[model samples]
Target: MKKKITLTGKILLGLLLGFLFGIALKQLPSGYIKDTVLLNGVLKILGSGFTSAIKMMVVPLVFVSLICGTASMGDIKKLGRIGGKTMLFYLGTTAIAVITALFLGSILKPGAGLDMSNMVSGEVTIGESKSLVDIILNIIPSNPIQSLANGEMLQVIFFALLTGIALNLVGKNAEPIKVIFESANELCMKMVNIIMLFAPYGVFGLVSSTFATVGSDAIIVLLKYILIVLLGMIIHVTVVYGGLFKLFTKQSIKPFLNKFTRVAAVTFSTASSNASVPVSLEIMEELGVGKTTRSFTIPMGATINMDGTAIMQGVAVLFIAQIYGVDLGINDMITIILTATLASIGTAGVPGVGMIMLSMVLTSVGLPLEGIGLIMGVERIIDMFRTTVNVMGDNIATLIVSNSENDLNLDLYNSKPLKKVA
Candidate 1:
């Protein structure tokens, strides 16, 4: 336990020290370090590499875990009902989140006074999709192996669902396949654990590189925009999530929040919910969410949940409107809420996902694609927070939904954390 705490503490401290070191490097004279390289370069490389390593596991982990999850479901009809409820809940919450953001953004109008005309376009590029058909088609992988290799999450999800369903139908014949997949799942988890060991180095690198490139000035320029985005996120997490938790579960929000706050903090710092999954699952189980519920909801939530993404889309659409001096009529706002909410489902669960969804939102509102560059400088910084909220929302939904379905285990949830297995 002591060793585990120390490791976790070191990871956290490294993230903080790395970020501070990065900011300090921004003040140094490049001439002094012309010959001798600085810590920034090292940190940036480590951070990016760390993120890549985490992403490296995303495809396999999601695919295998999802397959195992579906295969474990012996009843197809029950699985269908749970899936339908989950999707509807996810979609409903997402729509609510967007509406909240749209309402808040319109009311606050955070971008009104900002001068973006002089700001140069950011380096981030947005991909263009010609139609909804193309986007839908992209979800069906032509080759399963290629999809996994490419890390196409949606396609991977599609294939995993089918494979799991097939395994379920095969019954006793699928036992060997299930055992093999179970082993693969365990191996993938071990890979995640191994990658987590270097989390500090990766986090440091990512933060250092981000600050070095953007500097603090870009933050200053977009301070209001950032604040508004954050405020919107807070509202969704607190008001939306809190209310739902209380209403559905009839449990004290205090205990839930108390236990999960640490997890949320870690998610906030790490910015990869997939990376945060192990912790989130542990926390939820501690909070008394049953095994079936945790197993079913958490993985699915990780795959499709995007309340945070929805909020970002809402604010992003309004921000673009403000920057371009366009007033989005009520109809336009409604369209944005609908498009952003639906788009969140289709968006991949990876870094820079918000930007892609933002492009889709901007196009929906008739905002210039060029305006996206203005926000690009600060996108990475904000992504970390957005992802944290996304994961939190997923957990909250799982707990609430599980409680409502009478599948929750209140006693075990409030008990001590389980002993870590060797």
Candidate 2:
């Protein structure tokens, strides 16, 4: 009998092969046959199509799962407590992430020996960011249907929470509606599973296309900055999150990480926390986080829990300041952490949004905005790792909150041989 390859193994194989193939493709002559036919043709279709397929499930999964999770709670106070815990954990972790990055940046000095000439000269367009008051106001959707259609996650979340609370309040009268939502939630998970069956192929296409286009020149240029940022990510996950997992849940981090590898792979490949929500929820279930906790925390985390982005912002801020010969005091570090943590709340979980938020953070500290252009060359690759860390933070938060709420199944978490999902 042959040993079977798990989904994680298959995905890893795809990533490896895709990388080698992409490097090979990069070496080929620049012509229609190589560029138009292969890179833009088949690879584009496969990568884009797979991304679209998974994204198609995000709205429905979030809306339905959140409703089911919220309505099942039965106690509004419990729901509020859960929400509070989730927010606290998210914000705390994010602040810690930034501080860690700042510390690493200060010591390792990734920006040392680099001059302004290294800056990529391009017009960096900063997105129109909203005021704190405006951000709060925007969460209340004027039109729920429009929010869903537009994938306005914060608004969608607001509406879903209200709907779920209402359904829970109606009690016996809303039983039928609750049943429908419960059924819908299961259907959505099943759909996610079906789509994920093609994950390896999707991973291959996406990775290959990205590598073929990006090449390695940018990586070589910003090697130090990239390494320090990656180091910060590793420390946050292994030390901070790991410590929380042990202290709170009293479970080994190994199992949590084992169950989460698939989710991490999906997130890394896609580089969109929103796109990885379905996989996150599925993996959360396998990790024994109850629907009530996982559903709410995961989607909310996707939108707001950006520990990964916070890490990037902190390192980049220090890097930018160092390159410009700007001395940041303790006050500046605190501001970076606070600004990045709050900014994470409204930040969308997509590629390159980190750059936008980084711009915002830099402005807060009066760092030169041109520093963003310096790191733009390597942002795509870093975004992949940043997203993986963000998703991991979400899962860890879910576990902690679920355990506190008595919603975690320790037996299920510790169980070997995870139940096979499609």
Candidate 3:
């Protein structure tokens, strides 16, 4: 009998193989083979299908998880307090993430040395920027069903929270609905396991397709930008998250990091925080968080908490401004941080969503909007890294809130040794 590899092992293998295959595709002599047969055909479908599978599960999983989590919280006042803490932690961390990116990007100056004589000149399609007033109004969701159908996360989150709160208020009368959601949440989690079975294949297709289409010129040019975003994410995830776990909670971060390895692979492959919600919830519970905490933090985190995206946008503002030789004063820098942090709440978890939000950051600073095209070639690859950080942020928030509420099961978290590290 053959020995079975662990899930993490399998995912790492897939990532490695996919990376090598992508380079191989890039090395092909003519564009025809990559364009006509492999990239355009096999790789395209596999990549699209995998993302679609993850996306298909997102709405159902979020709705059920939010309902179940909210219903489980017996104390309305405690629930409200948890909500406030969650919002503070998420917003504060996002601000910190952007600040880190701004500080680092300014020092690194990734785009400062670039020759901008050959940039593609065209108006990039940036959706209209919403005023703070507009954002507040839209949160009410005039038609929640429409929001659900369109996958509008902010509105969807608003609706889910209300439904859960209402269910809790009705006492035993809403018990049946809550029970239905609990079962549905279980079913949805099972779907996450089922979908992840294809992750290796999906990773292969996603990596190969990305590299094949991007080619060499763009990769070489944007390699520095890629490295900058990656380093910033690492710093924020490590220093901010790891530091917080050690400070307020005083718990070993080993368990949190242990569970994150698997979650990271999926988030990195799919590049969508929404798609990663089910897995994050599972790991949060496994890491000893009670139902009361995990349910609310995880879903809300996915929708509005985007530290990683904010980091990217902050770094992007500096990179573009440096490339265009635009001089931004302290006021502009502050504006960039504020705008990027706020914009992160509206950004989705999908790949390249950072760039869309980055456009807003640029416009806020009077930087050239088309500077986005300069980095588009490599955004797909960087998306994988930032998303890993984003999901990590959500899990971190859950852990923090759980510890504070004394709802964490430390023994359980310490009981099971990680597969790779005990």
Against the true structure, what is each candidate's TM-score? Answer: 0.90, 0.96, 0.95
What would the per-residue lDDT of candidate 1 be over residues 42-75, giving only the tens digit for each residue?
5546876777777777777777777887898788
Q: How far is candidate 1 from the true structure (C-alpha RMSD, Å)?
A: 3.0
Q: How are the candidates ranked when ordered by TM-score, highest leading?
A: 2, 3, 1
Prediction 1 TM-score vs. true: 0.90
Count of clashing residue pairs in every prediction: 6, 0, 0
Quantify all predictions' global Cα lDDT against the true fold: 0.76, 0.88, 0.83
Q: Which of 1 and 2 is the better model by TM-score?
A: 2
Query: Candidate 3, residues 1-422: lDDT per residue as tens digits?
Result: 55678878888788888888988877776666668778878888888898899999888888777878787888889889899999999999999998898888888888887887665445567666776677778888889999889888788878888898999899999998888899998998898899888888887888777766675777788778778888888898779999998898888898788788888888887788888887888888888899989988988988778888888888778888888888778899899889888887776777778877887788888887788877776778778888888888899889889989998998987777745532
Write model 2 residue lDDT over 1-422, tens digit each, in one string.
Answer: 56689778998888888888888888888899888988888888877788899888888888998888899998999999999999999999999999999999999998888877855677777786665677789999999999999988899999999999999999999999999999998898898888888888888888898888874767787899999999999999889999999999888888887778888888888899988898888888887888888889999999999998998999899888888899999999888888898889887787678987888798889987777888887888899999999999998999999999999999988999845555
Which candidate comes out best when scored by TM-score? 2
Off by over 4 Å in 2: 418-422
Q: What is the lDDT of residue 258 in candidate 1?
A: 66
- What shift in Å separates residue 39 of candidate 1 from its native position after superposition? 5.8
